[model samples]
Target: MHADPRDARSVIEQDAMTWRQMLIVLLCVLLNGLDGFDVLSISFASPGIAAEWGVDRAALGIILSIELVGMALGSIALGWAADRVGRVPIMIGSLLVMAAGMSAAALSTGVVMLACIRLVTGIGIGGMLACNNAVVAEVSSLKYRAGAVALMAAGYPFGAIVGGSIASSLLVEGTWRDIFWLGAGMTIAFLPAIILLVPESPEIILRRNSPDRALAKINRTMKRLGHAALDTVVPIARDETGDSSGLFRGAMRRITTLLVIAYFFHMLMFYFVLKWIPKIVVDLGYEPASAGSVLVWANIGGVTGSLLFSYLTTRLPLRGLLIGVFAFSFLALVWFGMNATGLGELKTAAALVGFFANAGVVGLYALVAASYPAHLRAGGTGLVIGLGRGGAAAGPAVAGFLFVGGFGLPLVALMMGVGSLVAAGAIFVLRSPPKAPVRP
Candidate 1:
């Protein structure tokens, strides 16, 4: 009897993962890590850029916010486009955009020019994130999907660490322009590997094309993935009666809304820590270099947290895991706020906050990937992420306002702590989706 290829998830679930599949996941992780470098490179180079441009901290803040706006736009638009087009093409195109933008940014003479370039770069980073998350999830077996996504999530912090180290060393001998140039060059270097190794999602081809075309595409992908060719392709059974609005309809509407709320509040707290933790450390009497090191430690914690989350998903329900993570994040923030003062205490607090917050966000990505159907996965993921960028953008600004409004560090910490609690509550109320079957 011929094997049924109707359900893409079933095909992946039935096959034991091979080196080819592992390579696809690794490629995605590397791409996302590069994106992390690109996204946070501005932060690493900002002091040098500001000094050269004669701009103050406020001006630099504007520069940061503009890129977030571009990211929000890119995540929504390109993410939806990935569904209609394909993930690989979108991923490649976005990388090109990032390279061009970073290269242009290196030559920018004025703040306005640099801001525009950063916006373009942000668009590329944001678009890549949504597509990458969906593609990684699609290609992995159910048994390993969470682990794969968690590994991919670690790429961001890994990139940040790599970018931060390079920028720190290069800044002693070079200019901010040198940093952007290096980032651009590094991104371009990955193009060949991506084009050679990554295949378009088999699910996308089968969902969007005619049977003849789908069969050919499926066989091509299978061969690339080191699997035998299939005799034929059958489309996954799905109700076509619903409106094309995708994730916003029926049960998905509730799920989408809850995810958006959770993402927004979680990001609000997350960006707050990421953007301000160093400054907070400095205010507590640490040297600038020491403060920076603390931030790096936090990112290291993020990597650890992501890997832990991957392992934990195997042992716990998604909803409970996320809720617990967010709850712990809130407590960590409160602890950091109320008691962290000495060097050791500050470092420990930062790591704890980073661990829980970053893990919570990655958990959300995994949950979103598993909840949506293959056809709508990228778009749904994109929409939620795009909306969440609003919170990410607002986070730092709100924190700044709180500082200006005479809120002490403790108070500011409490406010962010509240955001985490709200996020936890959102997850707490969310109804978990029914478990999908894993075919042997």
Candidate 2:
């Protein structure tokens, strides 16, 4: 009996998540957490780095934004590459790049050198995010897909929380260089796990190989995932032009466009808070150590918010849920700006702001993962995220300009609040297409 090549989703949907599947998701989460540390480490160390280098706010803003520029480029370039190459190779290679860049960043003599190194590091991060999101979506059952992505997204802020705590403690005796070294060390340590435990997406194997080869790969994966072997693996019909180009053609064009716009605004607000909060805390009279701790509290809120959003995904439509999250974020940002005068109030406000803001952003990740088919998943996600990095790049730099121009905290908060409102509106207009089975 000739078995038509089956969509990978059918295999995944039929099987309950076994240990192997769970482990894959867990590893992805851990990797993403490390990414959080690497990406946000500069924020934690910015105060010390600036003071040591005598870098002004505007210059420091450039330093902060440069990595995002690289991330934007990396996401598009590497993410598109992952559709053709395998996700695992790109992910592991990205980890190595991040490790090298972070270590080199520790030795930089001037801001320019550090900025260039950070750009390289951001590329790895961008590539890793695209791969990680695609892997999690492809590997998990549909029932658990949103939750897995949310959990993976939470790893970032969790890493930020951990990194902040470490940075706070190290600031007592160590310089900012010490923090970068630590990030590098942590990134290097996670590499072996990816090699040993994480498997390539089975869907990718199907798309890239001959039918016989694809069947063998899928059966092997199925056995490992604790599922029965198929008699035949059927391939889905696809455009012959290529998987990556399919993102902009036909129905995908609108979905891709709206996702980019929503993510762009979401990232703008999210990164503004992530990159600048520590400095803002210091400006409010907190010491560097105290600022780290405050940021930790904010990330704690981020973790909680991700988990909360994960729960909500089960009950609400993705667009409606996101709209509510962005709306709540706007209110929270406004409140935090106005009411966060005392230290206690500031911490509380930071937590609330992080909760709403981070959740909104991660929800977009889940939405993108769910919206696209397997063939274009990584590239589509990467393109949206890469384009979104424009907002991420702009957010801190614009904030820096405002800071230098004598903009007050309340005004800055109002600007971010406006971004949140815009993000909400963008997602509200986004129309999701029918879910496609996992196939190239």
Candidate 3:
């Protein structure tokens, strides 16, 4: 029987997400989950942690915000380093540090000890995110890139949900230390998989030596993926030829700054909402359990929105798509704050806000990938995403401070909408850097 060429093509495309690919995503997602567990668990466990340590409420917020400081710094620094050195080393090192941070948190005796550990953990999360954001975007085909990035983005909420669930289980039976131990344990789980399977960037391979080995590896991967007809894996160095260094030349500098700003605003609102929503609900006279449930629904909405929008981005003008989504997000936030005071309305809006906000996030990632050429893809990705991490890192800190000032949820959502609008404006100003004509 003769095989269909289309079938083979399908296999090759799907092979981009083969089990090996899935594991890379899964491990990174798990690392995200580990980060989520620690961050979310802190909020859920704060009362207990504060009580046990005899710390004041003000100090606890600082303790929780500590890791974010490290994360923001690590994200920018390590992301830059990945562009200079390589992704794998930075990622692996970050994972190891994350594990240590968790271990430290597990054994922390006072507020100071916990805060120190949280900072370490934040740094580790930052490093891992910076590298992974670049690697995952560059590794996949353009066809599935948005979906892959969005799916990864969804991991945080899922992880938070998992953390919350675990918190419920442990609230009576165990201490907050148990949550840290589990989070750390998960970090260790991914180390072996990451070391073995995550390949070096193909672009890096091409520039380091003759293209032969790189092409050979591509051929080998293709063959394993059941494709033998791929005559060339290297495109004729079109679209701003040569390496991460090339980003500093021509229009790249201006564009790079825009990307950095875009990412920062995108993360600002996203991280703020993610870290604080449950707390906000609790403050609104709901029980901890009820608040957790609302947050869980929002997270579910976020995952759904990410999946839906990611799929949609491949077919639409991705940048414009983000603008529209965020506009909808602004509208949703207004409605959520106004009409959602009742139980039913609040629940409905919780899901919508989660979906729209995360969907907007997915669109931001797609835009990041499309903004630059392949040579400096990782660095360009890192530069923008690292800037975003600044906001993500600052999110908890800012939100915690704002909550203390007696701000309501309405104002919080509106403020984040401002961040979304800023992102939309920056994206509007961008023109896709020159593209080569496709052969028909």
For each candidate in the order shown, give its overall lDDT on alpha carbons.
0.77, 0.82, 0.67
**Tens-digit lDDT track of model 2 for 101-159:** 99999999999999999999999998898788778877888677767877888998998
If the candidates were sorted by their TM-score against the true structure, best first, what order would they fall in? 2, 1, 3
Local accuracy of candidate 1 as per-residue lDDT tens digits, 224-318: 77777776776656653223487888988888898888898888888777777655665676554555566677778888998888777767777
Per-residue CA lDDT of model 3 for 53-115, tens digit only, reads 776534655766666678777876887777657778888899899888888888888877788
Error of 3 at 352 (Å): 2.1
Measured against the true structure, the TM-scores of the candidates, in listed sequence, are: 0.88, 0.91, 0.79
- Model 2 compared with the native: what TM-score? 0.91
Q: Better model by TM-score, 1 or 2?
A: 2
| Superposition error at 15 for model 1 (Å) | 1.4
lDDT of 1: 0.77
Instruction: Report the Cα lDDT for candidate 3.
Output: 0.67
Report the Cα lDDT for residue 366, model 1. Answer: 73
Model 2, runs deviating above 4 Å: 1-9, 223-231, 239-254, 369-378, 431-440
The local lDDT score (0 to 100) that residue 81 gets in candidate 1 is 81
> Which sections of candidate 3 miss by over 4 Å?
1-19, 22-32, 50-61, 83-85, 134-146, 205-250, 285-287, 338-347, 431-440
